[model samples]
Target chain A: GESVGLHLPTLSVQEGDNSIINCAYSNSASDYFIWYKQESGKGPQFIIDIRSNMDKRQGQRVTVLLNKTVKHLSLQIAATQPGDSAVYFCAENTGSWGKLQFGAGTQVVVTP
Target chain B: EPEVTQTPSHQVTQMGQEVILRCVPISNHLYFYWYRQILGQKVEFLVSFYNNEISEKSEIFDDQFSVERPDGSNFTLKIRSTKLEDSAMYFCASTRTGVNYGYTFGSGTRLTVV
Candidate 1:
């Protein structure tokens, strides 16, 4: 079975520092990867995504990096803020229509 | 901006009772999906629907679970006989297009089976 997993379960960083979260996926055939932020009692919200064809994609304050060679994916947040503290999950779609397989998730904490 | 909406933010039911989770996806979205997350666990895909029919479904969506698009706006997931293990947060999501667009997820409905 294919699975997506995170290297770390929790991450802590300063308010103004940069944070990077790493994920590893077992299925090399996965063509699409997405990062989601979930609050305490809410559903996951899309943060950023990158296709297999591209190595990296950048958004307003977030960036997603994909390394197909090692089947690794990472999400980088610039200038972490208190509002950014949440559980982050990485998901992979294996050519299924909107069907996503999500990782265990990493909890991001920003220290004031 | 359009967004997905789910009903009954929280539900409480006894074991063996039936439960129905309702969701209304974005008006124009063509794809609909259902996912569930056990407390502290990862989100798992349950099913996907399009064109008034099921396009894909996971093993978890077995005989006890079913989905339907009763009307143009409502998509629902019904569990015939809920068990204690069925307690989890169910999320409904929709995408404007397949593969290219990001999915918009609803707030989620928490089902607690006692």
Candidate 2:
């Protein structure tokens, strides 16, 4: 699970289109970044991850991008589907053992 | 593909009663953690357990809250006296390694105070 804010930013995309979610991390020393997708009442499901040493990593149809200078991260989903709707969060591991700081999540909606 | 397991998917208790939330992390994992999410708020870290002791905890994990590894396979979070505000979804997570690797989170136990 990840920390959330008072409100979650929502993104709505067409079924066949692509969806891009963004997050700005606070710690400069964070070395590992993970993205999680959470459905309504369940726990977060790991989507993809990228380490500080790499700028980009790709999975089945998802890609993660990291910008060290700006401490920004983004998750890109290609050909979105109905099941793609969920809250997406970006978490950073501070290189301090196992503590993770999570960003406010983005609620994504996919429409057919 | 091992997963974390939590007991009592939903719990309802009196405001002043003591409630214990249980979790069974992946058998081979070395690190365990507890997290909670209020109705409309973000997920928050509560505590992290390792080697039969607490490794880290947040401010929210105050005097009334405690965690234990009473058995080899069970980890529990105990609230000495519950409050209405304590109603939330508590999640348990674990990782095989310390970091760099990802974690597996339990489905969660929804606690409700009556």
**Residue-by-residue lDDT tens digits, candidate 1, A1-112:** 5434534388999999999999988789899999999999999998999989999999998999999999999999999999999999999997567789888889999999
Question: What DockQ does every candidate get?
Answer: 0.59, 0.58
| lDDT of candidate 1 over B1-114, digit per residue (tens) | 788999999999999999999999999898999999988888999999989899999989999999999999999999999999999999999988985685899999999999
TM-score of each: 0.96, 0.95
Task: Specify the highest-lDDT model's number.
Answer: 1
After superposition, the stretches of candidate 2 with alpha carbons farther than 4 Å from their true spots are A1-6
CAPRI-style class, candidate 2: medium
Q: lDDT values of the candidates?
A: 0.92, 0.90
Error at B24, model 1, angstroms? 0.4
Give the best candidate by DockQ.
Answer: 1
The 10 consecutive residues of candidate 2 chain B with the worst lDDT sum are B95-104
Tens digit of lDDT per residue, candidate 2, span B34-108? 989887676778888888888988889999999998888999999999999999999999898875665989999
